[model samples]
Target: MTAERIPFNSYLALPEGKEFSVKFKERFPFSVNAFGLNIQHNFSDKYYMAPDKAGVEILVLGHIYDPFSGRSGEDAVLEIVEMYSESKERFYDILAKCSGRFVVFVGGKKMLEILPDACASLPVNYFSPAVVNDSNEFAVSSHAYFIREAFSLPLCSNVRSLSSTRFYHLGIRHCPADMTEVEGVKVLTPNLSLTYRAGELRAQRIFPRSNRLERDVNEVINEVSRVLLSSVDCLAWFRKPIFCALSGGVDSRMTLAATVGQRDNFQFFTFAGEGNARRDLLCTKKLSQLLSLRFEEIQLSNVHPSEEFSVLYHGLQGETRAPNVKDTFARQQYFGVNDNFEVRSSISEVSRSFVRRKFHTAEMALTADAMVPIYKRVPFSRKWHELIRQEFATWMERSSFRDVEKYGYDWLDFYYWEIRVGTWQALVLQDADYYTNPTVLFNNRKLIELMLSAPEKYRKDDTLQVMIMSTLDGDVLKTPIVKNFGKKAWFREILESSYLKAYQALIAR
Candidate 1:
């Protein structure tokens, strides 16, 4: 595909007095400039605007699902507008019940509010210094590259040297949750709402409401299964073709199980590559054959990245460089199958204590020092270490980390949800907008809270996933999951079991 054929679903927003350049205007024709805000998007349906009873204009970009009313797309947007019009104080509460990848812009008479989804999956990067400057010329975008270009911002010095070598060793590919590669620009963290008033912009936490009650583990599991299934059903309600990603992992398996009744409306696909990906291709083929489901395998080896592909990939992905850019391009080409919704299971990790170390206890204090090692496995230079440390500290300060106990949350789990997935996985999905319209069935805020409320033992194991699959389709769990590749898997399983036994014995003491 040529660069011109690449879709630009992202948007850009600027203050009232400022205007997008002629070049940008030509790219993004759908726009609304009113009530102290100027916003533009490439797709008209993805951008919706309506006035509330009070005449305050509410603009929404991207899709949303309201499980309560079984509403999605434009209907969901209207519901949000009505809810905000009714009670601004309960706006966050209303948002907590909905799920999607979206960024909302509410331009009131005196203030403008920008609300990202619970995971900030759509990503909002803005020029921080401009937000409070005397000229009030703030700029925000779904793509960080746009923000950098519009403001002539310098790239963060540390990010310029980032390469796939560092990522392979350290698992550090993206900036922290509260930062971007552009100097003086920051990303809006998950569960936080941003508002501009009196020439000042402020972001505040909105979810994990204080003084919440925990439920029984079984109850939480059952409710989570219901929400997961309902979310998938809601997606099918759109009458659009749905493509569910199938892998040999518990998360993707559960995502497939949730589509039990909607099998006729969905197709399964997997990426064929080395290691775990090859296993994924094998397992998905078997499962799909057994269930008589439509399936396709896209070979990652077929990708040959060109210079033009690199420029387009970097433009959409910004500073987050994936080693699989060629494969991503291949997937984008495969999306020619149809204009469909891609179901991903990436968000399911939030409930599985994903960031918790083997020996770390729930009571252990979460600090920048602790997080740095988790992200960067190999030792690095002092400058890089300090950069990673400072970035974690800033993210911790901006998030609700200090109040985790008050909200009945584990600090490590909170870190995984707010920082790890919120930053890294969210950016991955944003970059994938060029490839496919992706949605996570497990991204509902209430559903995630339900997963977190379960006992850690259940979450750490595959119990939660198994239980949900059992409820949806018992056949899904019949195929063995491919955890590793080849004879190495046998020895790795033994080592993992021995390590778990040792840890359990220590805990018993």
Candidate 2:
């Protein structure tokens, strides 16, 4: 018998009524409905499982790699299923070791659990109403539009009215980690698991199981390098001709170094039209020549708006701002047409003190007002500011800040991990799922924690990435890092470094 085929941009629907189910059925003819839920997705048979003797069904959307066992695709899925069947704690531990961009759905007769990857990189949004329905109706989808459309929820008035430029300036690239443009449709933040059972929906953190351990920097770097190489190897097993996104930045460089063993199966490329595209191209070309590797430049031109673009743009429901529309569209077009996997270093920022200011410290009291300046890059109306403040407060409360403190984790680093990379970068990947596949090596929870275990000084100076590159292949660093736009940019870079050093000295004193 021929196997079933699932398309891209899949969604899981558990409608409140039969009417919505019919709509979903019509939209996705190749879906499975059982245990009071319906799942329609684009994953292959390797990523899916039928209901077993225990009446449990599993579906894994996107790629997953088991670094411990060096498993990928079907084998990894089976390993996950076995671990999950054993116990939730074992499953969570396995998840911590695995690296990829995926969301796992385990559905049984009376309960359903939605587990996103460490960074929530695949974007899981569910309809969480103000009032409970006796039916225990719930809907979760990678695309928030599915939930909004199924529930017929109205767009948030505050978000819909903003112009595209204003939207971009407000830095509202996507909704807050916990919010969606559609009312009651909230995003599942990283390190948290959501459960729907007995007419109750609950979300709880699944990480930071113990207090932070300040490990030796060399030890952390050595372990991280080993895990990253394993991750790249696993990815290479599932997909061939992988493209490492080469850039002048440390993140991409570190990723490039990880591909050393799998260089034959990998190529390097940089997208044109990005802010540092030129510098990236030059650096990538030099590295390719030095390393004797294959390289390509993907020009972002001749990209006219299309009906599909319109659908995708609107489907985001104001989550993605206007300025990024074209870039997003073009990249999707390239990846969708070419059918290539792109390796990204987006999640690595968590290890490098991203979104952190020198003044911020572990001892500083965290509040919504204090976070506002860090979260927003541009000015907004008083109303918008207040709304954002409220969102931050809610996020802090929902994320269990008290637990973060108890775990001895720095609130600022945790914020960058959960709010910035977990939410922002995850949404970006979800949008990219429309056309292409992007994987991050640092998406593993254990790896991220290891990177974070290093002292703040090492993280601030890009020491983690530097050490990783040095360990993997020190020659890659022979080329100076990209300093874009000549003297002005150089001066700005020096000034920023100087300020950070000065601030650190003051704090030490």
Candidate 3:
């Protein structure tokens, strides 16, 4: 291997004759660094970055574990290294098999590649034609180390022709505009791979489909449960206490119950808002107490209407044209930020600017070695919202989701680039210290299958079904707080009110 570019708190080495280079955003924010044959793992308690011999890199940002056995047994970095070495040639195959919230970039001896998890947990982007290299240059992964130094421009639409990919308009945190030229930019799609080799670029799918050998509902449900259980169990790689976000909803209720029986070293966290049901919290508290496990309740105050624009702009990161006043306020309250008048004005202006400046095309926002900062802020205006809605609708129409299953894929589709990738991308890039929702790493598909597979008796009686699903029989639902509000009428009212408020706010904004 050549020593042309020294590793900066990193273990990046190029093969003989060929050289490698890197630029850090801030001196590699990690604790310990370990290296294996052609691979370097930068470990931090919160997250980790690993790069292998093939120049493929993976950045894990959230709680990832196997859902089945509920064990943190697998070594993700090592697995990635092994996978890349064995299947380096099959780009999409490598990406589809990896687990966790991450951005995977595979750069072979001559090709630059990018892929997101099948669930779109992390973000990745690309730009071509070396504004710095002049030779074919493309970047992948989450850092700007390669773009900031490699190119001399702020991360925004430097060129206009290439800004049509789906990643940028969706408010993805990893898609920056200052790194590469717009005419040469592309955001790699989730469950897909972009390969740039020998002056040619191609995109391909990697995830495989189920055999479609029809089976009974019971059988399907069992398999679903098994998959989810394994997925969660595998990801719980924590020596310290682990926390889960508990909601009074079906998805969360079952997850909490399963976790209780699966892992002993676990705690649950719930968020409480004014006028919201206490059932989930009550259940979480009771379960924790009963299990002799630790639990915490994170309470959020109500946010006012006046501060809606600011919160929405920031949370959505200049994308999302719809302005749901109550939703915005709710998010602000949940995030525990003061939404004053000045904050509103600043955010509104930024939102408006984003609407105005966003060229109706795809482009590279940054170079491979660019720094991740609050570059182009989103603007808030009715015109911006209208444009965004229309554009988003069109993008959805063009989306290619046939490759993935439609069970939990609804969330993946309706959310695709917007909520799933958008929300976390912004969080990871903005607040380095913040943690991600644990439920994300679990096997949600299995949960959905379980719900859909229930007998007609339980499935037909939605009320009874929800109650049963709220918490493990006595652990969560037995609490006084949960008992008081778990009534069918109250549950129905909560759903209706929340949905009504969301709809009204969306239209009003």
Candidate 4:
């Protein structure tokens, strides 16, 4: 667990007979020192002992698979420490061979530190009362939210929120500290370190993805897939009981299929909406059954608009405004809602926002509802939704995506930054960071390249036709449970005949 390292003296201070607790889910290599604690989760595995080792008392909540253990948790941590610096290399080398999420704590010289993985797919949180003290550090399942709930602080707001508004139009409260849900609090960033000592605090970034795209597409995709699959396998490492979030989408289905028959240690859970309202849930169920895996479907119907709004509120926090959701009246008006009434309900105030932006209402009126009728007649609405979703996947994308040719940076970079990082940041905040691969958006590059090089073959199926044709194998296609049950033909017909045809016709015209 040494690929990433954090000093244990960051977030701990001791009170007499101080009994502290650390709790982590799906993270590993839990460690504790007199001054602080170090926990390794999915991403990295090593914990740094206090450089200034004093009587550091540490407590940690770790996983059962932790490589080291003893009669007491503190002793277990000591057992895992590499006493010799030279041997440390080999020690971590072995640790890297291990995977999963864990939490560790170390405290000494009046400091406490906790480490979560760079890609924290697991569940972990920290909460401390608003008052800062020597023994005030706490860890929970949802750090910012649990902390805010524990301390009664309003959510933080920062540039991330604004970025979401301008592009994706969603408010998010759960971005890392680099982003503010409120004024002062921040979530720790991936591959980041936080040191709290002497009533003074410091934070620094330790890991960053390389900016260069020197590697070939095959290399990039292979490496990315390895890292991602390792993450998935680690989360599914638990033996006693395991569960996965099944979204009934391509992403989640791929994840489920990869694990099917691979182990008996896994279970799948999905949320089904009432009737047709929860098409995703139904689809997920259908897919799970086909896999013959243990499954649980949690049906949710009549969810208050507030619940979705709450997720948007705390999820994106300030990142989204009323103007972001197309379903919302304000957002519709902002987008010339009247023109797309059939696509969505119309708003009477479209002219006001359009006028303020110096847009001619009459011009927009011509195309406002243009998508609705066009969408209805299109044979590829389903495929179009996916393509558009990819385009608008990240909050900052919309800014540079339009007329991408005029933009300086590679359109690939724009797509990469938005989908891989920005979108995940928003999803992580919502604790809904499921199986969406940020890197997959880059697939468009491959598709485009292939199309340019060999347009005739690529154009034969088009995008929708290609995806549908590939679904011939029920076992291989990874469709969700409901869709697999009977909706396969239904979905195919709808996507191909109605949406796909309309979509292709629009493009041809």
lDDT of each: 0.71, 0.72, 0.38, 0.34
RMSD of each: 4.3, 5.0, 12.6, 15.8
Q: Write the residue-wise lDDT of candidate 4 on 163-233 in tens digits.
A: 34332322222232233344444444333345556655544432221222233434333333343344344
Stretches of candidate 4 above 4 Å error?
A: 1-107, 110-113, 120-142, 145-183, 197-199, 209-237, 274-286, 301-475, 478-509
Local lDDT at 209 for model 4:
18
Model 3 has a clash total of 63
Provide the TM-score for each candidate, comma-separated: 0.89, 0.87, 0.53, 0.43
> Poorest 10 consecutive residues of model 2 by lDDT?
1-10
**What would the per-residue lDDT of candidate 2 be over residues 24-140, giving only the tens digit for each residue?**
555554565655676665543227688887777887777888886788887888887888888988888887887877888787758888888888887788876637455457778
Task: Per model, state how many residue pairs clash.
Answer: 0, 1, 63, 80
Q: How many backbone clashes does candidate 4 have?
A: 80
Q: What's the ranking of the predictions by TM-score, best on top?
A: 1, 2, 3, 4
lDDT winner, 2 or 4: 2
- Identify the superior model by TM-score, candidate 2 or candidate 3: 2
**Model 1 local distance difference test score:** 0.71
Q: Residue 388 CA error for candidate 3 (Å)?
A: 5.8
- Residue pairs whose backbone atoms clash in candidate 1: none
Residue-wise lDDT of candidate 1 within 1-509, one digit each (tens)? Answer: 13343444578887666656676767676777755667777642464576566777877777788775677887777777777877875666667768777788886848888988878887888775654455666778887777777777787765565433454244446675477777778888777788878767777777777654666777876777777777877888777778887888888888888888888889888877776455788888999999999998867547576777777676667646656577677776666534568888888878886654332344545677556545534234455556767877877776656777677777777777777677788777765676667778877777787777787788876777788788888898889976635456557445544543453344211
